[model samples]
Target: MPVGYFVTGTDTGVGKTLTSCALLHAFAMAGKSAIGMKPIAAGCENGKWIDVERLVEASNVPAARELINPYALVQSIAPHIAARQTGIVINIATVQRAFKALQEMAEVVIVEGAGGFLVPLDDRYDSSDLARTLGLPVVLVVGLRLGCLNHALLTARAIHVSGLSLAGWVANQIDPHMESQAENIHTLQHRLNCPLLGVLPFSEKIAAREYASLLDITHL
Candidate 1:
């Protein structure tokens, strides 16, 4: 069976894609064939989702675009709204089928979720539902900024409630100027009940491959 993870964040712009790409590189470093999948994505530039492209670039395993991103909504908005606007239904079955295909193509598949864990995919379902359907361990990316403690704690609780294992979490230092960043990390380490896989420093020009070295994949 392929080892997979559902990557979600505390909130949007919390470095989920960056963490996902770094995981791909880290897995590759560990001599495992790995590919990254977005399943569903909102926002596109020049007819491409930037997150999908970044994942592809970081991946060592070659996969078809369709399997990597089953639903690539053009608008940069909430996925449910984007889908509704484009008359596209966000189907979990379709995503599952694509995920299975990716599983066959790699030893590890990193499935990156859109927005937060409970962001609605459709009126009837949300990202948490998709993670449950995938049945993969999740890796939460807690963006280190103001109000991180509440967001991280709430997200962790939700993951547990959803019956998914939070394999580990990455602390991406998104705000270089945030006060007491180390204290914040220390608090989460004690409270989250999971290993701290990595603490990524803020860097505007660092590549994912470089960031991969900072992550400890052993926790996952």
Candidate 2:
């Protein structure tokens, strides 16, 4: 079976794409063929989703665009709203098919979730539902900031409730000025029942490959 992971976050703008790309790079560094997938994306620039493009660039295994992003909604809004506006239905089956296709093309596929873990993809299914459908272990990205303790713990609980494994987590230092960040991370390390993959320092200009070294893919 192909190894894979579903990457989700505590909330939006929590560096899901960055972490996904870093995972792709990390797997590649480990001599494993890896690719990244964004099953549903809401935003686009110049008729292309930047996150999807970044994933493609970071991947060691080449894959078709359709397989990488099955639902490329044009609007920069919630996925369900974007799908409705575009007269598209976010179908989990379609995404599952694409994920299976990507699985065949690489040894490891890092599937990135839209928005948060529970963000709605359609009327009946949210991102967590989609993650459950894929049946891959999840890597939660906790953006190191205020209220992260609550967000991370709640998300971890939700993942357990969803019948999925919280394989690991990444602490992306998104807030440089936030005081007592170490204490927050230490608290989460003791609370969350998973390995701390890495502590990514805050950097605006660093590439995902640079961040790859910070991540200990061994736990993954």
Candidate 3:
């Protein structure tokens, strides 16, 4: 059976891609064939999305580009806005079909959601709705910094409210200078009601493969 997770962040620029790649590497390390999916990628350069490229690089299995990233929009902004500018309708069903196809090729699939948990996909559907539609357990990437407490709590609450399991969370230390980092993590561990999968400290450079070894996949 194909099994995996939906990786979402508390907010954008929170290392969702890094976490996704790390998860993929973790699965690969476990001797499982894994692939990464970016259902909706808004940022594009030249012709391809930077994040999707990185995801493909980290996966252990090969999947069709269209299936791996169904919606690769041109503009680097909100998904809904990018869809509008490109005259494309971001359909949940299309993404679902793509996910199903990817499942045929790999034992584990990591689907990375765009932006925050509640970010809009279209006027009618957001990332939350997409997660509900997919029915996958969620792994949140909490960017450790000021105001993370509120963002992480709100995102976790929304995930639960939407009727999905908060499988676990990754603490990505985005701000090296942020005060009371350990206390912040302690507070989240007490309140989030899920496993703290790993704590990623701030690094000037990140190699996803190297970072993958740091994450424990037992809870995942």
Expressed as tens digits, the lDDT of each residue in 162-193 for candidate 2 is 99999999999999999999999999999999
TM-score of each: 0.99, 0.98, 0.98
Off by over 4 Å in 2: none
User: Which candidate number maximizes lDDT?
Assistant: 1
Question: In candidate 3, which residue ranges exceed 4 Å CA deviation?
Answer: none
Per-structure clash totals for the candidates: 0, 0, 0
Clash count, predicted structure 1:
0
Global lDDT of each candidate: 0.96, 0.94, 0.94
Model 1 lDDT per residue over 1-220, tens place: 7889999999999899999999999999999999999999899999889999999999998999999999999998999999999999999999999999999999999999999999999999999999999999999999999999999999999999999999999999999999999999999999998999999999886478899999999888
Sort by lDDT, top down from the best: 1, 3, 2
**Model 1 worst lDDT run, 10 consecutive residues:** 200-209
